[model samples]
Target: MSRFITIKDIARKLDISVSTVSRALRDTYDVNRETREKVLAMANALNYRPNFNATGLVNRSSHNLAVILPFVTNYYFSAVITGIQEVAYQQDYNIILHITNDSPERERAIIKNLAASNLDGLLVAISSDADACAHFQQVIDSGVPIVFFDRVPDAIKTSKVMQDDYNGAFDAVEHLIGRGYQKIAHIGGPQGLGFTRKRKKGFLDALAKHGLPVNEEWIIHSGFSREDGEADALKLLKQKKRPDAIFAANDRKAIGALMALKKSGIKIGAQMGIIGFTNDPASTIVSPTLSTIAEPAFEIGKRSCELLLKHISKRNFIPEEVILPGTLIERESTLR
Candidate 1:
């Protein structure tokens, strides 16, 4: 069997002490620049790779992070993962992904089992049905730092990063109003999620600001799936007084609304308008396109990872909340 090259092998080849090679490889400030450069060159030539297991054994740090999310099939979640991976790669940390499929039971199982993984930290976007975050508290108390993003839970006291859902929803509604759509409706996500509540509040506030009637029936709460959107849209369109425009919580729901409206023989962008949050690629692909709010999903992921790293490095670091703004992208779906 071929043995892997180690720092000691590079040190011997360069006639230097193993400690010197170790410090040089880590780019420690105490090492001489020339010596560090020479050590790096020799290590590269010898294909020397540090044994992370040994390092972890000595330092009690696994240098690995866990990212638990509802799912990654959507553009927003996938893009967020990309952002997180980029930062993890740069920081020489490994990321372990766990998908809960939006099941609270599955999320609980994952969190409950994370204590044995020796993870340095955790970044999560909790499942919609997660009513309690006591499992997360157990993980935190066990010394694994956690930072949440996007679909964070209110019950958790950890750091969180997310887009400005309230402002995004407000902007989507106000834009629809500006386009001359009076009877506006909203298709929101599960009411339990923090972002969902924020978006709903924004929608309600915007309607009140414009003196529009608050039809409780017009605000439908459901899952964040296109199918959920379609179902809610059908219910609203079948009403005695149908809405003239719809503002969906996310692009997937918006596209679903479009499908329902098109099926009902309603002329989109003319007799009716549709707007959504999260500029998913499907938004542009759907016929007539989708006018919506573009969230900083990637930025949210990066910031969450950064915050978790901070907590990992400084155990006493106080938790913080970071909210990034979303931009409105006007498209053919809402054009007059």
Candidate 2:
């Protein structure tokens, strides 16, 4: 077996003391640039890497902020994470990730067991199953400050960062209505998510505003996934009178609806107008090029982190809800 290189090896090769080698490796002020460069070059050539877990005790208190979300596969969540990372890099804080996949029990378990003392703060985009706030409320009972983003629990009295989903959905539905689609359907997300309700309201409101009745049969509370969208779309299509258009809660569902329509020999766009929320990349690659509401995911992440930082500082920050506006991006799917 080969012997692993350490500071002692570098010091022995350089004819210097171990303390000097350590200082040089860490780029301390006492170490000269020449010596520091030599040590770094040698370390890199040897493929030496510092283990954060081992040296974290001597380093800062992990400088870590934990972010928990229901899922990470969606582009919206990915964009939000990018924003959180931007602030984390600027503020010199580490960001840890956790996912619960919308399971309420799992969400509770993760929150309950996390060492709040070790974490600087928490930024959460809760799961769809987060109907009761007892688990999150318990976090508040503890000392660690937290800020909820996107899929937050509205029932809880905490700082929340999300988009104006109602307005976004309203615009999409209204746009479809204006395009001469009188009977519009909504393939929504989980019934528990606040955004789902907001989107449903927008769909209904738009219909009512235009003197069209919101048939309860047309509204479906499916999960936020491609499969869910397909199933909901299938059920809607099988009804006595098929809806001319569908305004899905998110891009995944919208894409799913598109696939369902294609399989059933229904032409998208003018034949059956469709729009989705979240300008996910899939929206473009999918057939008919889905029109969508662009969520301010990156901004949501930055705002949530900033709000949590204020709470961490114990500055008597007031709890506030911030709803970032979304934009409408038209494409082939909803084109009339």
Candidate 3:
């Protein structure tokens, strides 16, 4: 006899049909209690262990979901992972994490090699430079549901969850204006991202709303890094007409700007005001604490997972676009 026992062995020992033994082992309500007891007794005697792989094949479910995103070391992404794990544990599902290192090529490679049978769904946050959605479209064509969170692509029609970038940027710029600072400039993220464009529009709209002059040279687009922020700030400082205030795309950049301004012997708040999005903890740790718009990262993860699960359960579920609001935190950086 084989060392590994199967349900067929139990069925034979109990003189019952294979289907009957399967139902009894599953504890289905339709199976009679007497038959179920016999089947259980036989299974125990035969040391029968069910194979999850076989069961998954029969049920067409793996109970596994994948999350692909950039930079897990980032504060915002780490917080989002925590929220995702919470929901996965409660629902008895497993999560498979894939890091793209913020590279479009890596993102595409991961999507290309996904094993459809091993994953029921996916949660994605596209790379900053991802300009195409055909790779994502292939996944959808293969019948795997996807729910995109922050930094999502616009080409595909699917469920998405993210912060209100436009409103957050608008509020950040308006706050600077309210503090009696004019000649405001913006340091934005990569141009390929939708959220970055939205933030830029908000910055321009806010300036136009107050009839403030828009200086094209003052607006700079670059990567979302503290180094980028510092470099962009230095470039602005060198300009003949320097901005009295700046609004960075994120907190890391704002802190970078802070460092540059301090090094240049410029007063942080009085001489120049600065604000950023994403209230990272480093905002408080830095000198002259940075003001920022706080994103609901954890909530975005939880909702994204929940929405993905819904799509898994019902393939025909209509896609939803969820936009969560961000809160503005005033700190020393913006204080006049």
Q: Which lDDT tens digits does candidate 3 get at residues 184-297?
A: 999999999999999999999999999999999999999999999999999999999999999999999999999999999989998889999999999999989999999998
- Note the residue pairs that clash in candidate 1: none
* Residues 1-336 of candidate 1: C-alpha lDDT, one tens digit per residue: 468776778878999998888878768789999999999899779765443554453346678899999999999999999999989888878899999999999999887777546789999988898878898888888888899999888887889999999999999999999999999999999888889999999999999999999899999999999999999999998899989999999999999989888988999999789999999988889998999999998898889889998998789999999999999999999986
Clash pairs (backbone) in predicted model 3: none
- Candidate 1 local lDDT, residue 139: 87
Query: Candidate 3, 278: how far from true, in Å?
Result: 0.5
Better of 1 and 3 by lDDT: 3
Q: Who wins the lDDT comparison? A: 3
lDDT (C-alpha, whole model) for all candidates = 0.89, 0.84, 0.91
**lDDT rank order:** 3, 1, 2
Superposed by TM-score, candidate 2 places the C-alpha of residue 106 at a distance from the truth, in angstroms, of: 1.4
Candidate 3 residues lying further than 4 Å off, grouped into runs, are 1-55
After superposition on all CA atoms, what RMSD does each candidate show versus the true structure? Answer: 2.6, 6.5, 4.4
C-alpha lDDT of residue 5 in model 1: 74
